[model samples]
Target: MIVFDKVTKHYGSHKALDDVSFSIRPREFVILVGPSGAGKTTLIKLLLCEEKPTFGRITIDDKDIHLLKDRYIPYYRRQIGVVFQDFKLLPNQTVAENVAFAMEVSGKPDNEITKEVMKILELVGLKDKASNFPRELSGGEIQRVAIARALVFQPKFLIADEPTGNLDPVTAWDITKLLLKINSLGTTVLLATHNREIVDNINKRVINMDKGRVVRDRRRGKYDYK
Candidate 1:
C-alpha cells in the first residue's frame, strides 16, 4: 500500500536519506530500526509530507505524494495515521475532544464524529478517560489517547516514531502489543524505534538503516546490528 521509489533527501550538503526504496503491502507490520542519525525519522517525515524528497517518488495506494495539490493534502492524510515520540495531545481538551477534534476539522457529521471518537477510544482502551485532560493522565494513558486519535479515522497505514521511547519497558511492551493488535486488524504499521528488546521480541520484519540507506532487511528477525 506504500512505496518508496529511490527516495532521497538532503539537508544542504548532508544527505539524510540516500536513495531509499521499499514497499509495504496492506496489513504488513514493518519496523524501521536503526541507531540515531540513521535516517529513520527522515523517512517518516518524507512519508508525512512534512519534508519533500530531494529525489524520487513516494506513493501511497498508487498516488504520487509530491504531485498532490496543497488543498488535497488532508484527503491524502486521512488515509494514514501517525503517532510520535511525544504524545501530541492538547493540554486543555479532554481525551474525547482531542480525538473528536480531528474529525471535526475534517467536516465530518457530528454523529459520525461522536461514533468514531467513542469507538477509537474503546479500541485504544481509553473509553473511561474520555472526560480527562492530558495532564490528568499517566504517560501510558496519554499515549493511548494519542493512539486513539490516530486510529479514529481507521487509517489504512500507521506510522509510529519512537512510540515507546518515554515509557518503562513493561509499558513499552504494552504499547508494542497495541501496535501488533492494530496490525492484526489489517492496518499496515511502519514503526521507527530504538527499543531493541521490543523489536527483538516482536519478531516482525525489520529494515535496518545506516547513514542514509537501508543496510539490511529481514523477515521474522532478531536484533542483529552487524
Candidate 2:
C-alpha cells in the first residue's frame, strides 16, 4: 500500500502540492487527473523520491520513503516501475537489449537477464520485434518497448505519465488495453494522464487535482473537467 499523509511540496515560494493526502491500496488501478501545473508531475516526483516533500510523510509498504538514505534510494526505486510520455530507448541497442539493459545495470546474470527480457517482451506483445531497433518501429511499438523495459524487473507498482500522448487515438487505445491487462494480472497501476477519453473509459478510481490540491476522489469516477 502507498500512503501520502498531508504531503506538501514547495518550490521557492510556490506550493506545487498542498497538503495532499491519499492512499492507494494494493492491486488497485487509479488515475491522477489535472490540468497543467496542477501538481500532477510534482506528486509523481515525490513518489519516485526524485524530490523530497517540504512537509508531510510518504510511506510505501509501511516504510517511510523520505527517511531512506541516499545509498538505499536506488533499491527503493526498484520497487516501482515508471514509464513516461517520451519513449526513452537507446538508439544503438535492439529491442531485446533495451529491455535487458535494466537488469544488466542491476547486475543480473546473463541467463536470467535473457529469460526475463524474453518474458517481458512477450508480455507487452512485442516478442517479434526483439531484434529490431527503436528507429525501425512505430511510435506505439517504441512505447511497448518502453513498457517492457519497465516491467522487466517485475515491480509491484507501475507509474505511467502521459504514456499515450505521442500516439494516435487507435494506438493509444491499444496501449490503454495493455495497461488494463497488466493491472488485471495484479500490478498496482497509477496512471497520470490528461486524456479524458481514456480516464472515463477505464472508469476506475479517479483522484482529481487542481491548484495543487485534491478536489475530488471517487471510485469508478469519470473525468469531470473541460
Candidate 3:
C-alpha cells in the first residue's frame, strides 16, 4: 500500500503540492488526472524520491520512503518502475538488450537477465521485436520496449507519466491496453495523463488535481473539470 500523509512541497514561495493526501491499495490501478502543472509531476517525483516533501511523510507498504539513505535509494527505487513520455531507450541497443540493461545495472546474473528479459518482452507483446533497435520500431513499439524494461525487475508499483503522449490515437490506446494488462498481472499502476478519452474509457479510479490540490477522487470516475 502507498500512503501520502498531508504531503506538501514548496519551491521558494510557490506551492507545488499542498497538504495532499491519498492512499493506493495493492494491485489498484489509479489514474492521476490533471492539466499541466496541477502538481501531478510533483506528486510522482515525491513518490520516486526525486524530491522530498517539505512537510509530510510518504510510506509504501509501511516503510517511509523519504527516510531512506542516499545509498539505499537505488534499491528502494528498484521496487517501483517508472515509464516516461519519452520512452527512454538506448538508440544503439536492441529491445532485448534495453530490457536486460535494467537487471544488469542491478548486478543480476546474465542467465537470469536473459530469462527475465524474454519473459517481460513476451508480456509486453514485443517478443518478435526483441532483436530490433529503438530507431527501427514504431512509436508504440518503442513504448512497449520502455514498459518491458521497467517491468524487468518485477516492480511492485508501476508509474507511467504520459506513456502514450507521443503516439497516434490508435497506437495510444494500444499502449493503454498494455498498461491495463500489466495492472491485471498484479502490479499496482499509477498513470498520470491528461487524455480525457483514455481516462473516461478506462473508468478506473480517478484522482483529479488542480492548483496543487485533489478536487475529486472516485471509483469508475470520468474525466471532468469544474
Clashing pairs in 2: none
Per-residue lDDT of model 2, residues 1-226, tens digit only: 9999999999999999999999999999999999999999999999999999999999998988999999999987777888889988999999999999888889899999998898899988899999999999999999999988888888899999889999999999999899999899889999998899999998899999999999999999888999
Cα lDDT for residue 111, candidate 2:
97
Per lDDT, what order, best first?
2, 3, 1
In model 1, state the lDDT of residue 84: 90
Q: Residue 146 lDDT in model 3?
A: 94
Error of 3 at 53 (Å): 0.7
Q: What is the C-alpha lDDT of each candidate?
A: 0.90, 0.92, 0.92
TM-score for each candidate, following the candidate numbering: 0.97, 0.97, 0.97
* lDDT over C-alpha atoms for residue 162 of model 1: 93
Task: Show model 2 residue runs off by greater than 4 Å.
Answer: none
For candidate 1, lDDT tens digit of each residue in 64-102?
998988888887887779999998888999999999988
Worst 10 contiguous positions by lDDT, candidate 2: 75-84
RMSD of each: 1.1, 1.0, 1.1
Comparison by lDDT, 1 against 2, better one: 2
RMSD (Cα, Å) of model 2: 1.0
